[model samples]
Each structure stands twice: as C-alpha cells, then as structure tokens.
Target: MDRSFEIQCPPFDLELSRWDTVFPHWGRSFPPSHARRIHCFSLGRNADKESLVGHLHVAFHHTVQRVPFLAGSIVPSLEGGNHQRKVVPQGVARLDIRDLSHKLSFDRLAEEGFSQHLLAEVLCSTEDNTPHVCLFEANFIDRGLLLVVSISHIVADGRGVTEMIKIFAQNLCKAQAGLIGYPLETTQEVYRSDRRRIVTGNGVPGPVEAHPALTSAAAGTHSRLADVGTCCRTYRIGADALVALKKAASSAANNSWISTNDAISAFIWRSIMVARHRAGFLDAGNEVHVAQPVDCRALLGLEEPYFGNAIYMTQGSLPFADLAGAATGLSAAARIIRAQIRTATAERFRDVVGCSERAEQEPHTRMKIADDVLAGGIILTSHFKFGLHQVDFGPAFEGRHVKALRFPVRGTMVGAVIVLPRLPDGSCEFMITEQGRTVECLVDDVFCRFTAETKTAKSVLPPSPTSPSRNGQAEFVFPESTSVKESTALNMTTLQAPHTGTIKIIEMNRPKAKNAISLQMLRQLHDEVERIHGENTTGGTRVLILASALDDVFCAGADLKQRSVMSDAQVEEFLALLRETTCKLAQLPIPTIAAVAGAALGGGLELALCCHLRVFSSTAVVGLPETKLGIIPGAGGTYRLPRIVGISHARDVILTGRRVEAQEAFAMGLCNRLVSHDSSGTERGRALQAAIELATDICGGAPLAVRAATGALSLASPAGEEAAYASLLHTTDRLEGLSSFGEKRAAVFVGE
Candidate 1:
C-alpha cells in the first residue's frame, strides 16, 4: 500500500510554439536543478487512506489524459526549422506513496518546522535522472496525509499548475461521488496550452530597444550559484505594517495611491540598499535595479486555464541616495516601481516578444541585463494573490485543508526575493536569498520595524535589565529627554515637554499596580487633558503622546484589587469618569499616539484605542478581556474596537477574551507600528522613542492645518470642517506652503 515506483504516462506527442522554444531547453531545465513547483497539502487523519490514494490515482490518470502535453517529454523539434523543441510521448511522470505513520506525525513535523530533509521526504526531489515532467509523492503520517504535487515549469507556470490541480480535483470529486470515468467533456473549464497566443508579435520593424530588465552583465542568464555567497532567510510582514507602509508611500508620492505590493517592494528594495551599504556591497553612487515578473495572461487577453509561461519581466532603477535616503526614500522607490509597471503595456510586451524571437534566432543577439542586478540588487517575485494558498484537493479526504504551504527556492541567484502567499492572518512571508553579509545586515531595527518575524534579527531582543518587572517596584525608565524639557507632576501622572517642539507627553506612573487605571489616575488624566486643552488654544501643543512609565506594562486595565473593594455604585461612577476621560482623549485637538510596550488588556486596551495612532513594542500583547470577567468593554471599547479592527475582529477579540500577540495585534490594525527592541534602549523606551519620532514628523507640518486634519479624522461636523478649512486660507503658513511649492523647496511653517 505504501511503496515508491513510477507510474508510466500514456503515449502522445505535442507541438510547441515559438514561446516554448524561446526558453532555454524549452523550459525543461528552467532553473537547471530546482525546476519543480511543489504544493504540499495536509490531510488530517480519520480519512479513508486507501480510498483517498485510489481516488487521487484515478484523478491524476484522467488529468494526464486530458492535458496530454503534461505527460510528454520536451525533445528536439522534428520539423527542424526555427523551432528548438517539441513535446514527445514518453515516460513523463511518476507517482509514489510512502507510509511513515509510525515514524512521524504532522504535529511533530510542524513543531520542528519544515526542514530541507523533511521536505525532501514529504515531496521527493524532481532532480531524478529520469526526464519526468511531473512528480507526485503521497506521504502518510500520523494525524494526516502529506500530499505533494510537483509539476515541471516546462509545461506550465504557477497559474497553469493551479488550473491543472483544479481539473485533477474535479476528477477526484467525481470519483468520490461513485462515478468512474466521468465524461471529460463535462468539465466546465477547458485546458488551453497553446503558447502561440502570446507569441503573436512577428518581429519589430527595427532593432528592439534594450529593456532595463535585461540590461545586466549576464544578460538573460541568472547569476551562477557558485559566484555569489548567498544565504536564504524568511521574514514576515504584518498587515498593520503593510497598511502603514502603503499610507506613507502614497502620502510621499503626493497621493498617487500605490498598491501594497508596490509599497512592500519599495520597502524591500530600500532595506536591501541599506543592508548592502552596511555590508560594503554597494557604493554611494551605485544605481540598484529591481526586476519584477509581471504575469502576461491578463495583459495579453488570454483565456482562463491557459498553460505555459505568460510572464514578462519589468524592472526599475534608482540612485543609492534616492533609493535609500532617510526621508521619503521608500516613497521615491515605490514611485519608480510604479512607473516601471505602468510602462509594461501591451506594446512594450510585444516589443519584448519581438526581441525574444530574434534572440532565439540569433544566439549573439540575446538581451543584456544591468550588472547591478546580479551584483546585489533585488529580483522580487510576488505570489500574493496567485491562488496557491487556496489549492483544494476536492472531496477525497472530506475537504482539502492545508495547514501550511511553502514554496522553497533552492539554488536561486543572489538578491532573489519571493513574496509568498499570505497567511490566514493576512501577514506576508518573504523568502529572500541574498549575499551572506547583506542578509546579516538586514536584521537591524530600521528594517525590522516593518517585519513581524524578526526573532532571527539581533535588533529584536528581550526586555533590558532596566525594564520594570511584574511586581512594579522597579525604577521606571522613560525615554531620553533634553535638559531644557519641563515636567509637571500630578498625583499619578507626569506631563513633560521638550525644549523646542510643542509636543507633550503624559506618562502614567502608578508603578505599584502596573500603571492600572485607578480612580486617582483617571482623575489626574482628566486634569492633564484639561490643562493640555487650555495650552493648545494658545498654540502651546502640536502633538500629544500617551505612554506608561513602567517598561513591562502599559496598563493592566482596571485595578482588580481596587475594583474588588468598590461597591456597584462606586464602579458605575468610575466607569462614567473613565468614559468621559477617554472621550476627551479621542477628541484632542492635536494628534495623540499611545506607546504600548507590554500588556494592554480590557480598559487598558480601550484607553490605547482612544489615541489617533498606537505604537506597540515587539513585546506587547493586547486584548479586550472583559468578556472573561462576565462583562463587556464599557469605556468606548464596544464602539471604537469595531471602528478600528472591524466588527468581526472586534467580536473575536472582545467576545472571546483572548490575548493577541504584538504581530497579531498589528495585523488586526490594533496598532499603527510595531517597534523592535535594540541594544541601546529598553523595550518600553524604544516604543516611546518611536512614538516621539512619529510626533516629530507630525510636528513638522503647519500647526493649524494639522489640527484641522486631526479634527476631520476624528469625525468633525461638515460645517465645523468647512470653518476649519476657511480659517486656514489666510494664514501665513498657507502662503508659505504655496510659495514653497512654486519655488521647489520644503515649506517652513510657524504656528501661524
């Protein structure tokens, strides 16, 4: 029942078009060694194993019969014209089943993570000496079955493989329903493998312009594995970070509006530039290129389920200063990428096709690529919405549920970045193969800010020795302040202002109770809000930051000990005051940011939610755990939670009363940014510093305009909004903005 052997494919010869022949070896040895595209499915235990394997076998047989080209080997074209290769009927595939139920389990494998050796066992290598175009390995283990399908890039692209799987799963579904040899003609979607549709471009009238994508030194060839000292590392970007990145990038691009892919690509490109600079792999004046593969199926009007490589390359470049500069660099990089993608029109693709045709005819006429690409620049491939994550196996084992899906890239060239499919939480995982030293340099705080999985990065460390403990008796460590800063202390809170800026900080310091919201703390917080409001009328404050003095705790929600001693009447009064305080906090005339370093539960989370922006440390955990206490969030949590992370997520968090990790919190839009801990500061201090940096960025804008925008965002009435806008029209700052734009310089604005 469990043995490894070849399953011979039926006989058939198929003709290939110019598109197929244009590729090296007709795409048979696409990447030389690692050409197989594999998808692993985890089928849980309790399914009928024999029935599942039998159904798959029958389904695959019918699949190969329908898509006969997949079951044929690429051979020299018998016509012997310009065509280089044709698919010949041969032993083109193998199917193997192995049972390791006693030796392994799905849970254990997951616990250890997927290693190369483990993946090899689950999905056998397609590098066998035999010229099989496809390979299937079914590994039976405890708690599930590991079904792996490896298809050669020779016959199909990633999309084509998905289509083939769709057909195969349909066949399996039919077999599962007790129907044998169901009519293939009944299939709703037909398979189309004619590469000629995309190769319609005859030849350019004159010499084709060299594309930036193919201007490298190697020119149409990938960097040799032996030439670059490359290493692979995987990183995950949370959804919140993605949102923030897209927003910032769009703002810097003057609101041109870029997609998440563009934003992340820009970020990755800039991060690489920084890493390369640190590793001494880049020069100050060097121009770095980013090559992206654009799928041409939709561009060329191809039908659904079309097979073959319908992808063309588009690339962009920027000087090191513009690409990796401290200010607006990511936005600049994103704009360049967006411009390049816009240029990849149908006409441009036809030109590329024409050039490819000529290259196929004349070996010396092949396109060349920029030397910077292979010499440490990035080649990012996005599989964001490829449908690879949702591959279904159809009713054989009840339903197809994939616990995890990984596309391993082995032996790829340096600066190779593959954006994998999104996880269930909407976070993205990227597999980057880059120079060893450059990869090492990527683990810094500057890069880790946008990444969720930074454990491998040295910048994300544990709490420093100076951080506060759970007992709350340790000395509080606040972020560094200038000597000219002024401080005002209330009972349980402190208000501080830097020497220059009008940005103010309200630090909660009830260290004995982990900065929990007590009656006195609430009263003091209300008094500070009133004080800040009066000062703001005279243009004294531009931004306000909410933070806790304690490092290990932002706030532990309500003080349980105090609440336990309170009567129902006292609790209701406390809730009323808490609600009023939060309302005032949210209605602040200036931007407010909460710097949360540790736990923010129930009322604590609700308090942070009142801010315009929330900055969380890597060690932070947040939740609305009132449901666990047989109560619902009372202090604006019910209303604001839904508005922030959506009703579904709000319900899941508040109703279930489960704590969310920092990454998950960010992914749910509970936090604006997640800062990592560095060796120079404590975790809480780092979060506070990040918040201050954000405040400083906001402070650079005209004060009145910033306040107006903040008011509009906080749900100002339409009339109020109009009045606010009209009030700013005659201000000196408005005149300065216009003059600066006309003069091509940054506007300098005073409070006016």
Candidate 2:
C-alpha cells in the first residue's frame, strides 16, 4: 500500500482538558547502543559556550539510496494489469542525515519508514569529508531510499528507531481510526558552569556551563522565548517569479550577497505579521521572531549527520515600533535582518549551535539552555526535499513515499515553524500562517474586512511614507552644498507661501538617531504647507522642494526608534499628524519637488512621489523595503507606487521587499531626474534650482492654466495621471519615453 501524508496519533494527557502536553521524558543525552556511533558523535563537539552549534557544518548526503517501486505497487493503472489483490513489495525510503533536525522532521518516529539520504549528506566519505553522518539505503525500484533518521540517544534510546515507525504506524493506526496525533517534546537544557562534561585529550575541561548567550547575542534586543507555533497552508509558485525574488534580493543588498535561508526567513516572518494582523491583534505591539536552523558540521569539522538535535535557532525580530507607523518600514527592517543573517551563516556560529550538549553530557540531565527557545514564538526551517522524494518501500510491504511535516503536532504558536518542498520555480513554500481571515487581510486589503468586528488595540498607526527623506526621525546628511537649512522651528503650517510666485523649501530636521522621519515631522510638514497656502505676501507658492541634511543619509525613512516608545495617545497623535501631511501634499497649489542623494526609503519614497518632480543624484537610492519589518506601506505607497510604476512592478518590489540603486530608480521613473554628485550644489541643489525654473516657467502661463495642470496630476490613479501626462504626451521626447519603456531600451528624441 502507498503510504502518503496520512494522520498519526500517540498517547495524550486528558487531565487538563488542554492538549498542550509536555512530555518531559524525552532527554538530551542517549545511552549509546553502538560504540562507533558515540565515538563519531563525540569527535565534532564544539568548545564555545556562547556561539550556536554548527549543526549544518557537517555533511552526510553521500549515503542516499533511491528505491523505486513498480507503478503497480500503488495502483495497477501505471502498469498494464488487472486488479488482483496480490502482495507486492512495499517500497522503503531510508533517510540518513547528520542533522537531528532533518532526521526528526523526516524520521517516522512512531512507526516504520525513514530516509538515510540525510546521513550521506551529513557524513564524510573521504579525507575531504567531515565523516559524521551514517547512511543505510534500501532499493524499491527505480528509486532508492536513504535513511537519515536521528534521535539523541539521551531521549528515546534505540527505541527511538522503533518509535518513528511506531509513530507512523500509530498515526496510520489513528488515521485509520480517525484522529490527529499530539506532539512529543524534545528538550531544553539550561547553561550553568558547574555541571559540565569532560573529554580526554583536551587542554582544559569544558565548563559545566557558561552564562546563557542571551546578553551577548541579543545585546539590546530582547531574546524571545521559544514556543510551539502551528499553521497549515498549501501554495504553489512559478519559476520566473522565484528567480526574480532572489535576483532582487541580491541586487538590493549591499555587496549583493544573497542566500536562500535569509530570503525564506524574511518571507516567513512577514507572513506571520499578516496573520497577526488578521487575528484581531492588529494593534498589539510586540516583536515577531523566527527560529532558524544552523548546521554544525563546518564548525566541529564533522563529516556526517549526527543523531541528535544538532540545530540552533536564530531570531528574526522586527518590532512594532518599526512597522506600526508606515508599512514601508517593514522592508527596511527586513534588509537589516538579512544583513544580520548574512553574518551569522559562518562556521563559528555553527560550532556554537552544535555545542548544546557539552555542559550536560554527563548522560542524564535535561537540556537547560533551550528553555527560552521553548518559550519564544515562531520557527522557520527547511527539511531538504531532494532526499525525501527518493524514499522507497520494501517489496514485502507496499508503495510508500514521504514529504515533510512539522514538529509540535497540533501546534500552539504565536507564529508557527514551517518546512516546504523546493518548488519547480526555485522558490520555497512556507506554512507560516494557517488559513484565517486575519492572514488574508495582511496579504491583501480585500481581507481587511474580516476583522471589522475587532477593534485595533493601537489606533495611532503611522501613515505610510516611502521616501526616506520625508520620515527623517533623525538626521543623516547626503554630502551636498546648498542653501538648505534644517530647522526644528518649521512645524506644521510654517511653509504656506505669502506670495504665489515663491518656491518654499521645508526642511524636517530631528537629527540625532539617523534622520528618520517621525510623526512630529509629519505634523510640521503639514502645518507648513497650510502656512504657505494662507500667505498673502509670498502668496501661492508655485513650487515646493523637500530636502534633508548634508552629511551621510537623506532621511532614512520613518522614525521607528521613536515610535516604539509611544502610548496609545501618542501613537494616534503620530498617525493623525502623518495623515495631515499626505493630505496637504496632495492639495498643494503649485508643483512639488523631493530632492535626494542617499537613502530615500519607505516613507521617504512615498513623500517623493507626491511631488510633481522627484529629482535625485546618481549616489541616491530609493525603495519601499518595508514588508521585512512586518508591515505594508502605510501612507499612500501601496496606492502610489503601483499607480506610478504599474501594479506589476510595485508588487515585485513590495513583496520581495528589495531596494534599488539610483540608476534603477531613474529607469523605473521613481525619480524624475538623476543628477551628478558634487560639493558645488549637488543633485538636491539642482532640484531647488529646477523648482524655481518650473515656477518661473509656470508664472509665465495663465495662473488658471497652471492650477488646472497641477490639479489633475495629483490624482491617485493612472487613468487620471494618463490624462495629465497626455499634455506632455504631445512632446516628441514623451513619445520616445513611452516607446523606450515598452521596448526595454533607451529613448532618443529631439525637443519638440
């Protein structure tokens, strides 16, 4: 019989009326069944107490056995045969891996059937190999089954082997009887210096324990406690989209270094945020975390998959402070997270991950350091898929194949851990969220109505601002020389032109943290706009220019650091002020220009697009980069970027959460003009000059004509923009521009 994704069941605790059962018997150290096994396992132990174990540094993949059963084994349809109930060999797929995580995820712990393929990958075959993984393969037919199942000898004993098949059988037994199995606990070991294990041939004995890596690893960030999170979803992705996702991530990152793990983790974290938004917890402010797996092979110099929980989880947290205001900050947060992750994929961290058992290796103590992990929320991991596809059933039984499933059966999670098959398109699927109305809203506004009955806990959501310059919470100056002065005095209502011909420059400066915009800036900007409009002397400010300081950054987007400290009242104040700014920008009487040189992110970009002209330097960069922080564009980025760049490109940037360089910014028309860098009035200075030119140019026209032109260009859709753009449509260069965009080439046109 073909064994597929059938249900499994085990014992349950009925007393509490809740199945969040904890099986404390599953210890971390095992009584060795084989001397060779213990010797091999001991060879790769790491010395570091603070670093995560190097679980993935080892490789045991070479031991795979692909066994294929005749099509007749599952169905007589694949073979030319009539239906006769004669016994055929049950194909067996033995999984062998050096990693305990992959083994546990893949092993049939309660029944029979596991793969040894993991063992080959985790173990060493030659001197070049680390040699820790164990492999045993079985042949089914054209497919070979690799057995790489692992359970630390400390917990289940060799009975662990029996437990897998037994669990499978039990599940088969339960599913046959109609039930879902509860999860079995693995363990958590705390770190202490007293109770340590000693090894021979060591310079000094390993400490009984060291302090938890909490303070050192986390620094200012709070370390999350691990908890079981569960979700269920089925998804499919196209190949081209998958490639684009990686390319975009690589291009957006500094040095363009991309990895599969970071991209997947970012994707999963955002998915959880979407789910949290759906669960009527939209206003609850807390950091979202994910437990990422690290292989310890390289760190310990091991060659095979060791039979234990050799994995250590990494934290991916983007607090509400960053994401609560403008949804665009999510992507920036993700980029930071991606960078942190990029640094963590080293052999040293891997060694730290594998060293979990060093202090408690005395053979009978529980894992003490993992308590926090057991308590924290959410996990993102991958159970390599290639090996699973090749598992085989023995000829004596029937056809059987296996895919991945989560640990913590019947998961109880703030965010669940997910492992997915690598898709044909090269992207990975993640069960970060179960199907829920709340999750739907996070991914799409169409689903926002699902939580209509629930009141948000925090009402002061920051407005979305995509331009980095607009949300400057702190000050970072892009090196440029201009007559621009940043003033805290320019509050809301400060910039209304007294004369219609004047071009006003509003500089929002709260310079200390990094020139990130804040709610206060939003209010100030808004009030100044109103101030200009109310003016009689310098009346009808025909053009406006928004610029930042002059040292390093041009508004690093929203002020997440400040927003994190706000209470409900303050948050609302923040949101209110922000909304006023967007509204004012839309209503401005004359043209607007956003001048930039450096990072114009999330809110910064949002504000830039509101202007009639977005002028930038070749050194400047622009993007939404917010979803990584667990949010979408809050201001008008969702509506604006799509309207400007078309829905397709916007979706690509938003979903992938990638940043683009200055050249790319111009190519996408995210900037109206790309200028050169210089101390003698840089791109930003040119922007101010350009605004004056536009104002003078427009002043020459009938005021009525200019106002009408300005009015239509400010609409939210392309249908409206198309009409306004039509006025420029008559120009020869405009035709070239449109043609060039369509043809994927540069435009060449003579001035009309």
The lDDT leader among the candidates is 1
TM-score of 2: 0.32
Candidate 1 CA-lDDT value = 0.67
Off by over 4 Å in 1: 4-13, 24-35, 78-83, 101-104, 112-124, 128-130, 180-194, 205-208, 215-224, 360-370, 395-399, 454-752
- Model 2: runs farther than 4 Å from truth? 1-231, 251-253, 277-287, 321-377, 384-386, 390-412, 423-427, 433-752
lDDT of 2 by residue, 474-570 (tens): 2112111111111242311223232235556765444453557754355447767787667552235556777765444566777886577566776
* Residue 53, candidate 1: C-alpha displacement in angstroms: 1.4
lDDT of 2: 0.41
Task: Please state the error at residue 527 of candidate 2 in Å.
Answer: 25
Worst 10 residues of 2 by lDDT: 14-23
